[model samples]
Target: MIEANKLKMQLKCPMPKLDFDVITLGHGSGGVLTNKLLDSGVFKILSNPLLDERHDGALINLEGKTAFSTDSFLVSPIFFPGGNIGELAVNGTVNDLAMCGAIPKYLSLSFIIEEGLTMTEFWEILLSIKCACEKAGVTVVTGDTKVVEKGKGDKIFINTSGIGSIHPKANISSKRIKIGDKIIISGNIASHGMAIMSVREGLQFESEILSDTTNLNHTISALLDTFGDGIHLLTDPTRGGIATVFKEIAQHNGVGIDIFQSELPIDNQVSNACELLGLDPIYVANEGLFISFVDESIADDFLKTLRNDDNGTQANIIGTVVETHPKQVIMESVIGGKRVVNMLPGEQLPRIC
Candidate 1:
């Protein structure tokens, strides 16, 4: 009876597999396995006519002036509080074109997958990419996949190339930003960066923080429909945050920009997280927000219209371009003092999208 019990225990013990249900180098070798991976996984979800063609490259037609942008997403932790690298890649590329007053249309997705990553995780990311494209009113018309040896690369990296057409009357440019131009922000800043940090640090707060990782193309298109060329400049504050965007445009237009710290929008939870980390929310990142420079005369009209949009409900006119301090960003402290805001000196958060 003792020997029978011992044999049953040995049968129930867990053991490591000689092989795994994970990605392997052969999946990228353009052989039978490559076709199976593409056929059974990626293409199964992202089914569109152009991608179905399976040509070496996608053939597309663009009318009028087309703006093309490409971005590579290498955010650490693959998945974060609000989004993963897949959604970030899609939204990031779409926002880049939107900043130029373009309507995003199609995209090409490419991936670098590390060996030993689970196929289940890869398929989840693929589905994420598909959903993001649909939400943005864009299509993933082409894609490529490559596999790297384990330990040499992260679990995954994504590269997205987007094509969009410039609006006919859209003459957005830094040169169009004059001293009288007003700066309007879409929503509360720093939620995205703080959300990522919150997950990484495992901090407990009174409230939960979620990343604002979403697409803004619809709202931006509405802005174009409302104010056409009255919009002077548009930018999404991502890596270096609102302060960095202000400094770049201020310098590019050779004008001074002043923002009231009291007017800056921030979430209470994100604020607490920032304070605990000794980080300033202004220099953090954002995913679903943007800054608009518009003519001073129509600033109120633009603000009201933007407020009606789902994402821009928290919109605020944070600052205006001024003639006093050329090529610099000045922030008016809540305590009634002014200070210069510059681009982030170095990498504040590494592997942050």
Candidate 2:
């Protein structure tokens, strides 16, 4: 098991003493309490020139094409095995931009807090947001905060919007995918979902499962720098995992996807937990991993280059785009039998992102 200390960023910003121990409705009233919360918590930890201006929004310069994406996070257990909702909010949006072949630059953070939440909990989440922004080399330019009456909302919910300039060499699109293209998974699958399940379901394994939640912008930037247009497309299997992602792409692009069960990458502990729970790892969620569809000629080189990176040590060529079965996904079993891999019937795990 990865140490919890290793999985989480050490608190860099110390918690400041506040007048109130727990939040109240007044904290969201845009009055003195709200100002105190922002000044002592959010603004202090995520300080920057643009954010310090305290404007309704930020002005950023973008020369070429840009990518914009936003998402809301609502996990049952705000604090999970490997990460909390704060980092997940930042990473989820950052990754969405990265998959668009963009270098993430700035983010807007918004929070919905429950009235009874302790100030200490809010401070910890802010520190995590600060750490995540610093790690991704992105700044929090603007945001909003609101507090709801107890029982009206979850402990806390986060929404993040991100914008970035597209990489010059990147030519990514689902339409770019074609027959003979190779599909490569960035790393082991199913880690993030199982990590959350372990905590939510009170299931215990020999070794703790850690969420694979980290920024993938740097890894993607390096790949774009080296491979250029040799890379055809990029996608992350977040909520519905690899199977759902492949099925969506195939149906949308009128293409066929063929995968091998033996080639799929998964950590042993996570795989075991999935077995015990009767879950298919391929349908599980992931945070830090991505799928790269590249020209077949460079498949081996692409796989090698990705494996050399820290985030891609467990990378593998899991599948290929084919023409045999249009608009469908087929997986070859470990015993060499084949079957259709369909879209998820319904939500396998809810609030997983």
Candidate 3:
């Protein structure tokens, strides 16, 4: 499901006519072509007071504690079922800040475009970026753009850096996690990875599998607002999937993780696709899912509250911190068995943001 963004509304702008149809090497030269591209496209759609300055860097103010994060997007087939590289880049950085218990405020967007990419494609991407920033309630402050030869780059790659003010009540840290803390997942698992795989492998199911790429900052903010320091640690299982994230946390914090296969939430289509592809959904990458380690006392309330939110209708209490088998993750099977969950030994998917 595409979770509704309280900040996003219908964008009524139409694409502007451009002098050129496709990007050329000259567009990256910091000369006339580059200026024209920015004037007609990037600057026009993403215009804000700070981005309008067109300076080498942006200036902004901050109070109290702050959180900063940066990430790059290179998802193959930049346009996926539910989103494109543009929004993916924005959501990635914004969610990164959210994971740190921050209210995201500003972003720096940079694009590396291949010479052969069409202007139409570029404009759609810019529109996505604008919509994503608006939905996340953030602004594009400063950025750089460069073009590469056809073979030197994929269609396009984006990098975003973001900063935000930390939530006053948030005390998110691994060290804060305790033996009885409950692990709650924001939504279903493996949708994003299976969505990409469906496109790459030309597999079709009863319905289209859309990427779960929506921004999670708002959802996270609401949780922090209510739970405060009761929320110990927050993390999004992006490239490495939840298993790897749990294993890392378990080893790093010297605690045992106990999860149940029966309680793990996953989409029917995603699970079927993973099975057909001989892939384990638990090891697949995800873009819009987050795992929260919260105090056991508040776990039931946390899961109930999360389930009411649009972004977390499918939330589940998947696991808990334990004292046995320290530095390891153990999952009870649907049958009466247990298995060790470890870090992914090799790359399961590539070019997936």
**Which prediction has more favorable lDDT, 1 or 2?**
2
RMSD of every prediction = 9.1, 1.7, 1.5
Instruction: Flag regions of model 2 displaced more than 4 Å.
Output: 1-11
- Ranking 1 against 3 by TM-score, winner: 3
Clashing residue pair totals per candidate (backbone < 3 A)? 0, 0, 0
Expressed as tens digits, the lDDT of each residue in 1-353 for candidate 1 is 12222433444322223234788999989898788788777787788899999999888988889989999998888887777788889999999999989999999999899998887677667767767787788999989999999998899999999999997768888889988899999999999999888888888777778778878888998889879999999999999999998898888778999999998899888888999999988999999899999999999999999999988999999999999989989999999999999999888888788
- Residue clash pairs of candidate 2: none
- Local distance difference test, each candidate: 0.86, 0.90, 0.91
**Candidate 3 lDDT tens digits, 1-353:** 24322222366557787778999999999999999999999999899998899889988999999999999899999998988899999999999999999999999999999998998889888888888888889999999999999999999999999999999999999999999999999889999999999999999899999899988999999999999999999999998789999999999999999999898899999999999999988899899899999999999999999999988999999898999999999999999699999998899899988
Model 2, poorest ten-residue lDDT window?
1-10
State the number of backbone clashes in model 3.
0
lDDT of 2: 0.90
Per-residue lDDT for 1-353 in model 2, tens only? 13224434465456777778898988899989999988988889888999999988998788889999999998878888888888889999999999999999999999899889888888877877777787888999999999999999988999999999999999989889989999999999999999998888899888889899888999999999999988999998999998999999999999999999999989999999999899999999999999999999999998999999988999999899999999999999999999999988898899887
* Alpha carbon lDDT at 349, candidate 2: 93
* Model 1: CA > 4 A from native: 1-20
TM-score of every candidate relative to the true structure:
0.93, 0.97, 0.97
lDDT of 1: 0.86
